[model samples]
Target: MPSPSGENPWSIPENDRLSERDFGRIAELIGEHAGIKLPPTKRLMVEGRLRKRVRGLGHQSLADYCRFLFDGHGLTSELVHVIDAVTTNKTDFFREPTHFVALEEKIVPALLERHASPEPRIKLWSAACSNGAEVYTIAMVMAEIAARHRHLRFSVLGTDISTEMLEYAAQAIYPVAMVEPVPTALRNRYLMQGRAPSRRSEVRIVPELRNTACFARLNLMDTRYTIDRDVDVIFLRNVLIYFEKATQEAVVSRLVGHLRPGGFLILGHSESMIGSNLNLRQVAPAVFQKS
Candidate 1:
């Protein structure tokens, strides 16, 4: 039933009445702007994610929100929030544990052996590092390796397309429960408890760890990366599924160019490099070494 005074479509129970043409329009524009592809299979998901934004912005429907965004002369102001809502940002401590395993067991030792002389400077990039779980994980591993090496230094760089996510990454604060998956020894060494009773128990990354890592906003679609210097390793995991094949190849190629010779490039377990023409050799499943 409508309001006692009159009907209100904005008050309707369903906000998913997105038309086919509008879906295509929104998907195309998002791809053009953010390099995020919204296929037909994601039409429902896109609508669901946009509903809250549309309602929050006081639009009656997704169609209206799209019209406002596409037709308005200067709706660029709202585009940021729209992209933030649509982008995937789910991450956790030690996500895909195997990658970390391979990192510690195989990659680090090899890098250490290869650059054993003169105390090499280890540099790592966590591209699309949402909220910094991956960055911290890398830091922990480097800290362990450093504990033994004594002379080597490390710098971990975290980058993402979302400015909001980058802010959270820089903060390095998380609920205590979220960091449980991190090993106990590393936890004790690198994570400090947040001791305020008023707030729920949480953990802050130790200053030593935070100091070694930095965050930046970066869009992977760009032809040239702003970080021009060669990096020793790159952890670009679980982000390519959002792009088309051509995009995946392009991104992989770009990542390869930055890797110092024989540097490691780790992708999500499910992401592949079968046909990618990057100058990389598969050293392990989903782990490639620049040629």
Candidate 2:
């Protein structure tokens, strides 16, 4: 039964057919504008995520919300929210721990030998560093390595597209659940577990580890980024899956451009530099060294 006006699609009850088309249009628009690729088959998931956004904006219909997004309003904010909601950020301390061990055993030593000084400095970038477990873990490794070497200095800069996620990273606090998987020694050394006087429980990163990291918001799709200097290593893991093939190549090219010659590029275990013509050669499983 249609409403009195008969043209208000909002009044037409929500159903599979209605959602499918709108979702496809949204996917197309996002891909065109931001290089994010969402398959048509994911229409239901997209609708489910955007339904809350539409309701929050007090739009009576998905069509209205879609129109608002497409009509040249401040839609980037909503799109960022959509990306944050849809992207899988499942990560933990020393995820794919072998990579960390390899860095400790071989890469760090080679870098130290190359510099041959009392204090050799390096900078690493954690691209798409969601909520910053990876960045903090990188700090932990640096600290541990520095302790043994007594002649190394390192810092990690973590960047993400979501402000909400960056806020979480800045606080350097996590619930007990977040620290449970961390190695016992590392947890004790790097994380301060306690409750402040006025509030709930929290685990804070110690000053030594916290000082070694900086977090910021950066849209990888944006060509005019502020990262001015070359980086020694970049962990651009698991983010390319959200992009189309061309976008993936572009993103990889941009990331590779930031790496110093002979620096490392690390991707997720399931990710690779497929279809990307970067000057990086695979050195290990999911690890590539820039040539």
Candidate 3:
């Protein structure tokens, strides 16, 4: 059959093509376990992404991979890789520039004033932090704020379902092109150029900024998050668009419980509509504050 992309699955060698039945099973498992809705349109994409996994696992075909996963007890060990393969990690430093502007100009100052401690420690979370860009971005903003306000301290927690991404994020290295979105001044302040010739095309977040950031693997589909509940700002951006509406609301509601009173929740620009009923007030474009 011709897939949605107008490619005939049968045109590929039989061992490489994914059958309809196997695609359906894979879609069901991904939706059930990850809350990501993989409709028919995504079949070709999924099949393409999993081909490397099939070869890596020494499977002869997509069918054999499915059988190994479903019938041959490979799922328990392979599910994480499956999820990693499918979950899209589209992120860049300062991807949405205005969000950081608001964080630095408005949000952080407001939170600092409201905090009662002698030396306030602001807690920021990048809920679906992909490769640590968002977390490090937040750290850069917080570092600037802390410099001006001598009594302030901050920590950033970056969590993602992809252990693969979390590991990459922990390393804090990126192609020089990826850091281009960061402002020149902040880039100079927070990023260190690689000293070795082979690594010259890469930059690493400075040890000082890296020390303020931490990464962890967290499944948002899980009912409870094991991190701090007094988060001053939660950046749950972009990833929500991939979920069903009901799942979107459920995830946002749970995250809302983690925010301190007057703390902020920032969603992707497209996600503004989902959390209207959850004790939040729209404070900016896709930015919400807990009452």
Clashes per prediction? 0, 0, 0
Q: Of models 1 and 3, which has the larger TM-score?
A: 3
For 1-291, candidate 2 gives per-residue lDDT tens digits of 432223343543564122565677677766765567777656555665566667777987677776777675747767777666555565687788878987788677756666646788878899988888999988898899899877679999999877778888888888877778689999889988776664356688998788899988888888766884568778877778777777788877788888777778888776765523566778777788877
TM-score, candidate number 1 = 0.87
> Global lDDT for candidate 2?
0.75
Ranking by TM-score: 3, 1, 2
Total clashes in model 2, counting residue pairs 3 or more apart in sequence or in different chains: 0
Q: Pick the candidate with the highest TM-score.
A: 3
Q: Kindly report which residue pairs in candidate 2 clash with one another.
A: none
Give the lDDT of residue 220 in candidate 3.
Answer: 94
In model 3, where do residues sit more than 4 Å from their true spots? 1-11
lDDT scores in order: 0.83, 0.75, 0.90
- 240 Cα displacement, candidate 3 (Å): 0.9
TM-score for each of the candidates: 0.87, 0.83, 0.95
Per-residue lDDT of candidate 3, residues 136-174 (tens digit): 999998899899999999999999989999999999999
Model 1 stretches astray by more than 4 angstroms:
1-17, 55-61, 274-277
Residue 162: error of model 1 in Å?
1.2
